[model samples]
Target: MSILPQLAFVLILGAAGLILRKRILFLKRNILLGKDETRNDQPNERWKTMFLVAFGQQKMFKRIIPAFLHFLIYVGFLVINLEVLEFVLDGILGTHRLFAPLLGGAYTVAINIFEFLAVAVLVSCVAFLIRRNVMQVERFTKPEMKGWPAMDANLILVIEIILMFAILTMNATDQILASRGDEHYLALGPLFFSRILQPIFMGLSDGALVFIERFAWWFHIIGILAFAVYVTYSKHLHIFLAFPNTWYSNLKAKGEIQNMPEVTQEVNMMLGIPVENPSAPPAEIGRFGAKDVNDLSWINILNAYSCTECGRCTSECPANLTGKKLSPRKIMMDVRDRAEEVGKSIDAGGPGLEDGKSLLGDYISKEEINACTTCNACVEACPVNIDPLSIILQLRRYVAMEESGTPAQWNAMFQNMETSFSPWKFSPSDRFNWSEKVKEEEMK
Candidate 1:
């Protein structure tokens, strides 16, 4: 009969595991729907990038207040999860304070630290809630963040705050029960932060205190499990994806645009540039660039799914600053939305990418892509190292290569660059005249 609670716990955990596995598969399948591209060149560099950017929260320091607050929550939440480990073991073994007797003094110290961190996490979350909602931060209030995105951000914060409260509540009630000489509740020294709440619960009966403690324990664990599953669908999916996203981030110089191998090879053949390997296979070329989620690389789609939709990229974009339609943030969101739409359709026996809808025109507009200055501001601004410009370039490639011709001004620049080796109308011979004219003006 005592094992019944343990059995129920096992069942609940197993269900959560199954649901989490389903979400993982759904995310993976949608991401893999994209074309393959090589992003696995440097293991050491990738690890460093992940460590510095994701684990270390290095880039987030650009805005110190939010970064510090976020770091407190990030670090505190992680540290406090150690206590959660004890909670899980207690649940499974059907024991109260399972680690307390084993670790003794160390367990008390550990939980005290966890309690302190829990308080820190609680405070940090409240600060973030105010910054995001009450303060109405500009980056957070963008058009893409209007509905679900905004609510998801707030909801995650609220969940964390509530979970922190559950921890404090459990500890306070456990302390009270311990004082009352409850056999099951071992007195784990003073959890200083939670002790402040002792007076409030002191008036409660021992039975009531035990019930509250048990309820809070269950609540904390259940909330964590549910939060894990909810994150896959939330912008907080970055919680899992940031590591991989930063690792696979573009390693080359930011402004150095990637050229099509097919186009490069063709140009090389025309220039009589010797082929490095004569026996090598010819470059593969099909649809010029991304028309839909199907047209982008797996990493690109991964980038879409990994997107936090924080609007940092859009907020930093020069075009967006100039009141252009281009929100680099929106481009990523559109790709993710299109991928989900297509993935669901294919799963439902619908037309998939061929359903007369595409990522190019139907989801992301031509004006949005065209408005990009390609200044790489969005790329630089992304905290998790998400490359929105890479996605933008691919969409632009479809317009130029497949759909034929970019904006008229871009066409003129392309023509000039090909003929005169410049983006101006001047002939190659007269290109030096500008330098001479500069010299003449200096003399005058």
Candidate 2:
């Protein structure tokens, strides 16, 4: 323990903190770029949702095998990180096993528990890698996952394995050093998993063993800090965003679609209902629906950011099963990519970048939007409660209302709805005629 290591630790920790802060601020700004809507109702329900979905991971259990494996990694991540508090204090205060003397026997138990979790995490990561690469799970190899998405997934799994190994290695070497009465080495009973590694290092000289132990110690802590910052830039961001995203999730009935106030007012006027008269000049007209990220509600953007890209949504989507261009998972990924692009553009220039492209044409396409049956399957399948349907509806609204780009069949259906109050060509007065004909045929 020296001032130099403490100072280096402080600087590394500070740099990671600063980078993470900047990324978080950028993400906040990007998410806030969307239109504002109030979702602050039912604080009690919101908290319950966050606890059940994010913390409890209730939705993940739909598929028992994968769910159990995922739970191992999730629990491992949380439990193993408990040791990080000790790591921080040790690094800053130049102490070793700072909590060992205080906790007494409890320290050994905690270390053993951490070691067990570390092994579980390592095994889980390897299993995940095999699933993604060797087994080539269909959902994981979708077109959207061809490049960086695929790499990002593998990179995270590998990083977790490495970090876990670092922890076990550090513990094993520390145990060996303690046997030799090395300074600052606590003689806690050997951690089960780490104890197995001790035989491999027994032949090394005292100085080499010390170097290996210190290197592993520094690598584990530094790797964890680096990972904290890397998560903001990776799909792994859901690790943190899932909590708030679930907390602010849409709590309305699944089948309910929020109405456009302006459209509702116009419909009211057409139906001869009394409407409020404007007392002053009207506000400037806005686009009918979302042509870009800015026209979508903030929650929709947040959904994009919080997406895990697990493909459950896409796997469940009927349109995708039928070989349509649409994949709800891809839609969310596109939205996130477009939002990131816009955020970077604004960072480089100013608001002037708004004119160049949009989420509609640049990232998502009309065919994909049209393919949606609005079955809500994607919404139902999302473990994180993301509503890909909401984004689809907004983009569809922009196409139909602003661009008037619906196909001829859809246009005919729209015309029928406007005049006949149904999606058929017949008048509303004759809407029941088909039922009457069916009754007559049955009677005959």
Candidate 3:
């Protein structure tokens, strides 16, 4: 209950706020570096998507066991963080249990519920760690998950375990001190999990008990604050980004490819479709498609940040399943990596960075792009509604239109589509020849 502690609390909060603000701004800037596209329409549908996909975890439920475990952690983390509001108030005012008097009996209930959730979170985190490390789940140990991705997954699980332990420790010591009738300790009957731990702290001196309680309390709050900041730099950013990403998710039919407006206009003109403003000056032609992150739509870039790297998309991808170089998860990671590189370069100098590298060659490869069948499996598999296929299509477009780099067989197919109106070497009039042959065979 000192001014010094209150001041220190304010300083810590301010520092965390400042760093978090900078990180958020950096992410926003990087995401917006991509070309702008409208995804703001259909507000109702967007909200429904956010609710079902992000909040309800609709896609996650496809796998029941993992889904149930994830639900516990998700709910526990969000619910437990509600206590942070009281922690903040107490820290700023140098008051202990600031909400205890206001809530009266309900305070005990809330604390007990929080302790239950804390224990659940600890157990769930441990289970996830075992699944990732001990069980070595195939989806988790894919080549893309080798270094930082693997370590990051384990680190977050460990951090959650430690934070949950801190919570229990704080509550247990506080309960012990309250039983001893220590000043400033609230007599909140007993938190279930903490009550179980109370025996460990028995017989400790009043001052020692107080010190342990204070240490746990400070550690829990500070750990939460640090986790908040760390998530922005980690794949766990999906925890926050999933909401908006799902809200702005593509609502168009999965098989329907989005046509380029410039190309559409040119085609309309070529077909003599009674174009309006025929005398208008021609629009400047930019790159045909996304050669770099900047050429992609902002939503596409946002998808990269929103990716959980769970490899569900890769697991479902036909390309990856059949010994192809393309991994949908890797595509997302590469886009994020490239975006961060470009964002940092621009932050350091100015606009363009002549890094002599691009998302296409340096980060992602043409082979990977061509490997995609565009079956929409990856998009469908994404729990947060990320459209890695959209990025893939854009990159493929760049390869086809800008570089004319399609393989010989693909180029032949393209020529057939243009001249024969089908991906076959035959005249348009002969398109039904196979059908006639099939009918004759059936008759025989």
Q: Each candidate: what lDDT?
A: 0.88, 0.90, 0.90
TM-score of each: 0.94, 0.96, 0.96
**Cα lDDT tens digits for candidate 2, 4-81:** 999999999899899989999999998998888899999999999999999999998987777888899999989888
Regarding lDDT, does 1 or 3 come out ahead? Answer: 3
Looking at model 2, report the run of 10 residues with the lowest lDDT sum.
276-285
Q: Best lDDT goes to which candidate? A: 3
**Which candidate would rank higher by lDDT, 1 or 2?**
2
> Which parts of model 1 are misplaced by more than 4 Å?
270-284, 418-421, 434-444
Model 1 lDDT per residue over 1-444, tens place: 379989988888899999999889988999999998888888899999999999999999998988898898888867887877887888888988888899999988988888888988989999989989999999898888889889988999999999999999999999888878888788887788899988999888888887899899889999999999999887788877988999999999998988777777777878999866757888667788888888888998888888888788888898888888889999989999998898888889999878999998898988999988889988888889988888888889999988885889999999999988999988788756769878989999
lDDT of 1 at 313: 88
| lDDT of candidate 1 at residue 439, scale 0 to 100 | 94
Consecutive 10-residue window with the lowest summed lDDT within model 1: 275-284
- lDDT ranking, high to low: 3, 2, 1
Local error of candidate 3 at 291, Å?
0.7
